[model samples]
Target: MASHSLSAVRKRRRRRAKTLLVMVGLLLLTGAGGYLALLNLEPSEAVMRERCTAVVGTETYDLNPDQASNAALIAGVALRRGLPPRAASIAIATAIQESGLRNLDYGDDAGPDSRGLFQQRPSQGWGTQAQVMDPIYAANAFYDGLLKVPGYTNMPITEAAQAVQISAFPEAYADHEPEARAFASALTGYSAASLDCMLRSAESPGDPSQVAAAAAAVFGNQSVVVNESTVTLQAVDRAGWATAQWAVANAKQLNLTSVSFGGLQWDRVGGWTSAETEPGTVTLNVAGAVVE
Candidate 1:
């Protein structure tokens, strides 16, 4: 009778152990399944990129090719000239109000004294007709005067512009602040590469090489190299590409070099190459060759 009871007890312990092992295995399987599901799921807004065009006074301006390109230029200029985001926003707003991103040859009657993108007065030492008409030069000069204003960032856009221009109608500048703020938000790196431009006309001639060159002028040299079906970037900062062209133009100030795009695998050697073999692990590459 004792032997039989001991046998029964051993049988019960064995059953319990088996049950516990099965439960642990099931839990581990569930955890792994959940992890795999999360890995495969696509995030919302993954396809969205930045837009470069802005709306001003009920008019939609297509900036993708030219007007859009100016945002980077202006941002780069402002940063290089040591102006803050507030100043950049104010300048962009002033440009929107004055020229609508178009460098005009003529000014309205109210702007006879006005010229160039910001409509500076020649009499006020802003610049000569030829000099004021130059966008880069005009931008630099505007920033020079803007940097002199005390507490400009704390002031309203209208007040800030008034301090710079002292115009007869201070309220006019106020109306353009929203658009300026939006442009400034993009320029100041608040949003990551959210400001993009779509080519309005199919005939619009945009050279990626030229764009890249122009950007490199301010930002620095960036290259995409492929080796054995792998792409590699050297000394490039991917985040900086948001303002790549701007950085190229202000290269002297930013001292930036290299940006990569469109996915080449990167490794620790400051080297990026295409995956030579199937990824042993699953991978995701977002816009501009970035792996998330």
Candidate 2:
């Protein structure tokens, strides 16, 4: 009887092992099917590859969407304050060195209380922790410090940045000078059609009012025409390009489908191409709507 019971237990264990093997096989097959489905995804369902580039002369600088957005805000603030492109360059370099143009919520050992894009420390009277974490406030504060530095516009990018930042590794700012200058030149409208963002298709319809409000926040009140899914900012010359490029830098967050100015159009897939857009207007179109 004991021998028969032991044999029964062994048979039951073998059946369980067989069941586990079948389950593992099914899991592997399911995983492969999912991968195959991903491989055959439609163009409309392609994964997002979002990035922006600033190309000026022989130099080209690439920034991920978040960094590009922050860089745009910094340059826009400089434009609003009537500061020169040099000021934007200095500010961009400093931000790149200190925070890689990201609005960080924490700090390193050098500035245990630092926050935001420029890493302004609350302990040093930059602002309250909440205020320092605000990108707009942080950018304005950095510009305020830059403006206080006499002859900053004429100083080398590193020196100008160091004068305002007083960073421990002052020389690090110089390393980002080329990248900063390229972005500044394109964003400031000194180089037309020099900034482009390659992004995935917009996920949903975008709000034109929000775009207009953001543009106004950066470039001040302007002649704006709003349609179903488009907003035309009546700015000409370099200013038009500045507004257009600013829209491009912000395209990811704004869900912008296209930005056209000075007879050039930048769309999500086609990049920059010649268009019939008027020279004196910067027209922005959002996704999933008719654009007039």
Model 2 lDDT, full chain set: 0.86
Clashes of each: 23, 0
What lDDT does each candidate get? 0.53, 0.86
lDDT of 2 by residue, 4-118 (tens): 9999999999999999999999998788667646444334445556789999777777999889889999998888788899998998898898888998999965588999899
lDDT for residue 36 in candidate 1, whole number 0-100: 45
RMSD of 2: 5.1
Model 1 lDDT tens row, 1-292: 9999999999999999999999999998787667545443223222333234444345443343344445556665676555677887888777766677556667654467677777777877888888878777778887878778888889888888777776777788888777666655555555333343421111122233344455445434445333322222233232343353232222222222222332333221123344443322112111122122
In terms of TM-score, how similar is model 1 to the real structure? 0.55
TM-score per prediction, in order, is 0.55, 0.84
lDDT at position 24, candidate 1: 97
